[model samples]
Target: MNNQRRTVLKSGSGAALLGMLAAAGIITPGMALADWNKAAFDAKSMADTLKALGAGSPADSKDVQVTGPDIAENGAVVPVGVASSLPNISMVAILIEKNPNALAATFVLPEGTEANVQTRVKMGQTSNIYALVKSDGKFFMATKEIKVTLGGCGG
Candidate 1:
């Protein structure tokens, strides 16, 4: 099998094993999941989400970059990218202002690693996307508005 297929199989099997364990109570549901910012992910508003993320007052930064299509053809799956030229970026998060959950994703960067990440997220409607970056123990962010269309057919 190709490397990509092998990796997929390995991950799939791991998830299956974890599911079995959780079902059998050998592992609790929480034990089967990775550590994450639950509060941030569950926050409904931008202010609350940033508070949960420990970025209560993030400064706007030109070094931070948020890249995505101005119009996402499909609201079910919108591609987003976040990067930063600032130094010591220890964390990166993508936030959607109008989504049920403001914070969509977060990545913790190891020391010396570049602050660049990309992911796809669901958008219920048009919203502002923010790329929040933690650099040198300070929080910074950039934002862009993305219009979400219903299948690009104007439903």
Candidate 2:
């Protein structure tokens, strides 16, 4: 039994060491970094956010879906989700129309990843939420409205 335990420990340590090496850039290069657009996230308007994201006036699409509560009791952490049935989806972004910053969140999907995400966002008041989906270098959107009784952004 002691010998079997030693063998298992050795195998686990070997796998861990390999993972550490890969993370340290010894096994693979340029695999740890992700593309992030800072300007889009900092934008305060829908148009600016689109421009920063290179979406260029997305069209409305039924293929995309936005899901969330119709009414939120607290504005501080309203749950939101975006999902797409469209093929080859590369990105998903969540935007709140009435927030100080329109663009709330952006997610970049790696190849072969399913185009779906859920997150909590702060909403100052009742507003329309937009889920922007990008597929094959083009953009599409879906919208939903959520009412907030208590202000989340310092009400």
lDDT of 1 at 26: 57
Model 2 accuracy (lDDT, Cα):
0.86
- Encode model 2's per-residue lDDT on 22-118: one tens digit a residue: 5764444333322345567778888998898899999999999999999999999999999999988998999999898899988889898999899
lDDT of 1 by residue, 1-155 (tens): 24433443488677677567557655544432334556678899999999999999899999999999999979878899999999888999999998878898889999877788889888888889999999989999999999987632233
lDDT of each: 0.83, 0.86
Worst 10 residues of 1 by lDDT: 27-36
C-alpha displacement of 75 in model 1, angstroms? Answer: 0.9
Kindly report which residue stretches of model 2 are placed more than 4 angstroms away from their true locations once superposed.
Answer: 1-36
- What overall lDDT, based on C-alpha atoms, would model 1 receive against the true structure? 0.83
Distance from true position, residue 109, model 2, in Å? 0.6
Q: What stretches of model 1 exceed 4 Å from their correct place?
A: 1-34, 151-155
Please tell me which predicted candidate would have the highest lDDT against the true structure: 2
